[model samples]
Target: MLRAHTVEDVRRAEAAAMADLPDGALMQRAAAGLAAAVVDLLDGAYGRRVVLLVGPGDNGGDALWAGARLAGRGARVEALLLADRVHAGGLAALRAAGGLATRDPDDLSAAPDLLVDGIVGIGGRPGLRPEAAAALARFPAVPVVAVDVPSGVDVDTGRLDGPHVRADLTVTFGTHKVAHLVDPAATASGALHLVDLGLDPDELGPPALEALQPDDVRALLPRPGPDAQKYTRGVVGVRAGSGTYPGAALLAVSGAGCGLVGMVRYLGPEHIADTVRTAHPEVVGAGRVQAWVVGPGGGDDAGSMLAEARADGVPVVVDADALRHVDAPMPGCVLTPHAGELAAMTGVERAEIEADPLHHAREAARRWDCVVLLKGHHTLVADPAGRVRVTTTGVPWLATAGAGDVLAGLVGALLAAGLEPYDAASVGSWVHGAAATEASAGGPLTAGGVAVQIPRLVRATLNPSGSRPLE
Candidate 1:
């Protein structure tokens, strides 16, 4: 899994490394890596015009040192020192390498092929300074390579507070930051490249969220043995849809019907149940279930079934309409709530939850004592213990109606197949997102199409060469 730690975790990791090594060794290593990437971008560094927007701290030092390396390779480099004070050693090294440092902002009209933004790093707050903002406005056409992080982005929170630099490429030091995984800021970071600083992963504190790599999800997937039967694997009971909306039930069942799941049970209106049975004859009515997916379109009727499932000690995935029925904490339950449902659960306005989803999702997880999966641009899955995983692979086209029902059912399938609530939710989200990508293919996709695409996507994730790409 690709893990993204918070800025505090990164700072601690950096501090630990700095204490073990020489004073300037970390900075040198970071600069060397940055320089190499910049050179690669230049193809050959003979007479390439490189511009560095320098700031006051170690971030500026990194830029200056990288500029020196480029100068040594015969690249004509210029540094625009925005701050009054700069890194003494790095600045002197750049000067010795035949690089010129100036304080004027107007001279930035010499738009180079690439701009290295050293204006702010992970430690700085979001939004640009007066001088830095003005200078960047001059070169709208130049492709930017952000050092450490794109300036004016919340490094720790991944939320964009204001105007931020949209980088074509960002070379970050040590580990991936929260901004690299979370939305808004993650979207601003065009293409990310990490420079290994040899920081110990175990030494770092808990990460904000983790992205499930193919191998990670593959390892978590359930495999049936030779003697495995339909009843032996696990039974998932899905209580969703009503007379008004039968398609929600159909879509959820489609997501859950992947061969990974042994059996699907229906408990709702007869017509909707008939629709599910018509589409997939394998499903049966509610029997003893290993896990339950309660919600989708069954508005008020969801409460009783959700309560029954919660009382049975079976792991339940509470979603959509059933979100209101989440009365008390269930130890092994998973709650999937979009912003509006999350607001209802947390007793806050939908706007407030939308503003800062990470904070509110964690709050709900803790309060409900269950795994909370908040659906949005960057789908966040948080456990009651505060561990979180963020899924970053969906597009705007996946926002169609009944999309969430498909996701909830997918998670239910995972839960029935014997994954923990957290792992099941995370893995299910990964599959849901991947399926959406395959279904969309850059154009609009219906919710049904997304659900239909899950089985192939799941197979591809499990065995890379075993499945066909969605056409």
Candidate 2:
């Protein structure tokens, strides 16, 4: 699992760790790791030209010390002091190590091979200073390496309000910030590299955000027992599709009956149901089910279907048109909505919801007292209790039509398989994304193509070495 800590949590943990160590030891550790990463990027620092945008804080100190290390290794390192008061000790060390430092903007005439952004750390607010932005404009095409979190990004919320450093790589110490995992800021953070400072895990408390990795998803997967039967395993019901969109029903059933659930129960118009039965002969007419997925392309009849599904008293995966009917608290249901649907449901602008998805998702989950699965580039599943899990396994090709319907059905299948609302939504999203990636192979794919890849992906995930299972 990839865990992301808040800025306050990071600060608290840093203080606790610093108390146990020497004064300059912590900065030295960060500097050594930063320098080593720069060297690897340069493929040997000899005769390389490196420039550091020095600020007034510890971020600048880290850059200065790392610059000193590069200077010692035959790199022509120069520090551009952007602040009136820089780290005195770090500046002195840089000068002793043969690195040149100048407060004059004219000294920045020669653009270096790489730029180090240490203008603002996690403590600073969102925008960059005029001089800092000007310095960056001087070298428009240079690859940048940010010290910790990208300068000028909201370290806690992952929102970008103004000018922020767009880095090719960000070397974070201790642990990841919310900005590194969440979007907007995450997009600015080109690639992430962690430098282990070995802080106490106990002091960090619980993470604000958690991302499920392959191993974590594998552990959470539901495997059938030896005596598992059709009824014993699980049954997922789909109340999606209409005369207008029969493909929605087929796609939803395809996802639910992808060998993850034992049986599928499809309840829709007789015509659409016939189509579903024809495509998936194993699916049966609705009778009893462990879970129900409602409203994919359901038009005006969505409310009635949702009401019937809710009457069954089973966990429900609400999507598309059904979101508008969600006026009351469902308690244990999963509400799947894209930005536009979510905006309509909450009466907030779609732009606002997309800008700070973490906050909006959490608020919606809390208000509805259920799981809010907000689908996007990085899918987020937030529970009423405020815990969130980010799904980061899909490619851009997964944005095609009917992909969300497939995801909704998969979530219902997981729910029927007895995973809690939170786990069901998050795990289903992870699997759906992985399946899309496998199906696409860096090319275009339809929603049905994605559903067909689930079983193979699951088998591969469970048996990464492709060895025979103990059947």
- Index of the highest-lDDT prediction: 2
Candidate 2 on 80-193: residue-level lDDT in tens?
999999999999999999999998767864768999998989898998998898988888999999999889898888899888899999999999889997877888887888
- Residues 427-466 of candidate 1 have per-residue lDDT tens digits of 9998889889999999999988988898878777876877
Q: Candidate 2 at residue 289, lDDT?
A: 95
Instruction: Name model 2 segments beyond 4 Å from true.
Output: none
After best superposition, candidate 2 residue 322: deviation in angstroms?
0.8
Itemize residue pairs with steric clashes in candidate 1: 127-152
Leading candidate by TM-score? 2
For residue 302, what is the lDDT in candidate 1? 83
- In model 1, the runs with Cα more than 4 Å from the true position are 42-44, 465-471
Q: Give the Cα RMSD of candidate 1.
A: 2.8
